[model samples]
Target: MSQKAIIEALKNPDAYDEKVFYVKVLQTHISYIFLTGRYAYKVKKPVNFGFLDFTTLEKRRFYCEEELRLNRRLCGDMYIDVLPITLSDGSVKINGSGKIVEYAVKMKELPQEALMSELLKKGRVDMNVMDEIARILSDFHKKAETNGKIESYGSIDTVRFNWDENFDQTREFIGRTIEHQDYSFIHRAVQEFLKNRKDLFRLRLRKGRIKECHGDLHSGNIFIADRIYIYDAIEFNERFRCCDVASDIAFLLMDLEFLNKSDLSNRFLIKYLEYSGEEEDFLEVLPFYKCYRAYVRGKVTSFKLNDPNITEEEKERSKEIARKYFQMSRQYAEEIF
Candidate 1:
């Protein structure tokens, strides 16, 4: 089906469920999301990034199912199921009795105000929420999958590859988004830390510190309802989602720091350590993961600058946000001192 057909189908709420209310459409670089008041349907775009491929109908459907299965680990009720979009007689409809053309992952929409990012903006995020999150994450990590194969991802080589990929991807945007000195300093710090702590990375693997974790844990992915719903686990690739739990939580830590909530960040980490029963010494290697996480945010925002759909003003804003993330990455690297 054409994009025009999809847009038209989106306009008609009847295409999805039995409802007449208007459906809201949200777009990201890789997906078109239709919000139908009570539910949201996410359709992956036919894009091929080297790391993830959803370029074919079959691949998109597989990933849709993978997303539903993986996300249901953390968000039990949020992820409903994957529904096939059918096209026939010059029209497209979701779950229609026709030939399947596309696939969508249906989900239960959470309240906008309950998003942790929005809560942080209003200074409404408190230690209580942090503590609750810490507990939830602790329980989650305990039950998270672990095996020899997944543990290998925590090796120094694998860890370094992740950092190397970040540096390589962002190198072209040096002067345009991040200062050369900031990039150089962070690169050197990360390399040195990884080199010096090969033993620590190995020890983490030996201790089963590596597992299938919530690869993306920024504040935006978390909803602070009665229960904390950490949705959107990386389903496109296991390499992205499998790692030391420290690195997983570090993403959230770096996000809080990016929002200028260092005190809460510290509180959250401390509570996490307490609940997870990880030693205080785990703090030593945290800067490494935190820096990596910050760089990832900068990298992602920098990529947004090149998107054709983004307005000039939005691109400029993204440039500034990316710069700030790079700056934060440098600070985290400095903490390694």
Candidate 2:
């Protein structure tokens, strides 16, 4: 569909004017999120990246359903269903009995402060909340599925691949944006640490420390409503979701530090280790995984600089966010070595 068509669809009064319905646009980044009364509808953008494939109507529908199914594991009562949007002649209608043109995952919207990210920003986050989150995530990881076929996911090769991808893609940006001394320090730290810790990485794999997990478990993806709810998992790619559990937790750790709550981050890590009894293993592989997580954030935010949809001011803001994440990755690497 054309950009104008998409915008028109978004502005369609009939779609939101039903007596029983009310629509509000929530967020429009990688995907479009809309709030319809108590329900939130998420529609995948028609973009084809090698990592994610939402390019076709059929694929979008399939992934929309997949998102509902995967998210239901955590938010069973909140994830309602997946609905199709049909186009006939020139008009669009949701769940119409015509050819499916697009798809959206429908969900019950939670309160804004219920989101851990928003809570952290307002200084409402606390250790009790972190402990609760730790317990919830630990239990989830214990029950998460593991792929018996992918040996690489638990091996040194996976660790190496993570680093190689990060360094190769962000070296130029890091060189340009970061101070020379800071950049060199991080580079030497990563090299030395990886050289000396190859054996530890392999050992973690052999111990079943790697499993399929929430690929993106940062504060933004978690909700604290009576219980911790983690949603919006990596439904489009298995590689993103399947890996060492430490890698999964590292995302949260990186997010906490990014929010300037290092004390809480440390407390959360310790509590998670205490509950899961996996502290030693996590300590061994955490630095590497945390660095990987930070770099991934940097890489993703950097794409905003190239997006035509974003204004110049937004692009500058994205660049600053990307730089912050790159610096965080460097700091994690230095702390490890």
Candidate 3:
């Protein structure tokens, strides 16, 4: 089924349950999510953005399965299953006995108020929650996959590749969203830091700090219910997800700082370091990773300006957001040598 048809079908509450109260459709750059009171169904768009390709039905199915399987590790209870959307007699049916046209990952609908991002807005994220989050991530990183081959991604070359890709992709927005001088200065600062800090990367690899950690560990992905539920791991690309533990943690820390919660960010980082048993010296190399995380965010936000589905108002908001993130990235770069 086309995205429109699939979304229309999901908008009907009876698609999931006859007694369901209502259905709400949410849109992202790459997916359409249907919130059916009790469950949320995420349908990936048939688009190829170079880094990820879900244009084919087979690829969508595979990624749906991958999303369900991978997210189950952290929030098994929330990730329900992947269901096929079938085209029948002039209508679409979810998990119906017809020709399968697309796939949707079903999940238990978590309360919006419990989301860490939302909680942060309400000023409800306290020390206890931060400590719990720190402990959960520490344990997760400890058990994450690490091998000789995956560890190689922690090398300076791979780091360079990631940054180069970022710089190349965002080059067009240099003068519009990002200042030319700031871009060039941060670019050089990052290159010099990576070139000069090979020993830090090497030390991380030797100590097994590189692993298959969550690539997107921002506040939005975290839910503070009975326990912390960190879902939506990046299943499309391993290069984005697999990295130094500090880099993974840096994303969340950067997100907190972006939200202007430096007190919480500092508390979370200190507690995380104490729990992970990492040396305090690890702080020295964190700003570099934070800059990378912030730059990636700006790149993503700028990409939304090109999305046709969003309104003009949204584009204006995204423009401001992209500038804010780019400035934050530059701030982190300034902290480096």
Candidate 4:
């Protein structure tokens, strides 16, 4: 069924047990998030966006299971299980024991204020929270599995490919939405870094600095309730999530800076370094990784222009955001060299 039809069905009282269950659509992006009473059900959208493929029922089920399994590593109590939505006689029901039409990864619904992005926006965020989050993430990274066989991650060729692919993909949107000044600066900086940092990249690889990590570790993906919850891990692809630990931590640092919380960012970085005993190594890669993270943000913001639901004003705002991130990327690159 189409997304609009699914959304419409959710609003109908006849579609569910009204007294016992209620469905509230929370977020609709790559996935559809619904609040079913105390739990949130995340259903993967049946769209193949190259980077994420969940077009088939089997693929959705597989990813749902993967999401539950990976998320349980951090949020064991919160990530309950993957349940199938059954369709029978033109009606859809959760755990109906009928023909499975869709699957959702059920999770304990966390409060909005608990999310780091929301907390930061309200000026309710504190250094203590960042410190705790850093510690939790550091511990998770320490325990993460690594592949001794894969040596490409630490090589200069691979590092160049990462930056090259990012810029090549985003270059088309440069003059269209992103400011020309910002784009020029980023273009120059990326080229300069590629020319100078070959040895450093190889050294990091030999040191085993690369490992499986949380691909998307921004403020929006973190939560601090009774305990820190690092949710929304990249379960769609291993390559995106598997990288240098510095790159993973860089995402959070960039997010903090973007939120205008540099003090918290500093504190978080310091705390993470203290616990992991890798401050010098982190410093060496921090600027480059921050650049990478900022460019990723620019690309994502630029995508808003393609969203039909977004108004012209919103598209303009997204362009401004994209320009700002591109400028930030340039600044990080300059700092590195």
Estimate the TM-score of every prediction.
Answer: 0.96, 0.90, 0.97, 0.91
Which parts of model 3 are misplaced by more than 4 Å? 17-19
- Stretches of model 1 off by over 4 angstroms after superposition: none
Clashing residue pairs found in predicted model 2: none
Give one digit per residue, the lDDT tens place, for model 2 in 15-62: 532332556665435687776667677888777655688887788888
**Per-residue alpha-carbon lDDT of candidate 4 for residues 68-165, written as tens digits (9 for 90 to 100):** 88788888999988987777788877676667778878888887678879988889878888778878888888888778644455466666777677
In candidate 2, where is summed lDDT lowest over 10 consecutive residues? 11-20
Candidate 4 ranges beyond 4 A from true positions:
12-22, 149-151, 309-314
Instruction: Write one digit per residue (lDDT tens) for candidate 1, span 1-337.
Output: 6654776677786687556355888777678888777888898878775667888889999999999888999998999989988877866888787899888899988777899999999999999999999998999999999998898888888888888888888998999889999999999999888878778887788788899998999899999887889998888878889998999889999999889899999999989999999975477778888888999889888987778767899899999999999999999999885
Model 1 C-alpha RMSD vs. true structure (Å) is: 1.5
Which residue runs of candidate 2 sit more than 4 Å off their true CA positions?
16-21, 171-192
| RMSD vs true structure, all candidates | 1.5, 2.5, 1.3, 2.4
Residue 90 local lDDT, model 4: 80
lDDT of 3 by residue, 120-188 (tens): 999999998899889999999999999987788888998999999999989989877888998998999
Residue 158 in model 4: lDDT: 69
Would you list the C-alpha lDDT of every candidate in the order shown? 0.86, 0.77, 0.88, 0.78
Q: Which candidate wins on lDDT?
A: 3
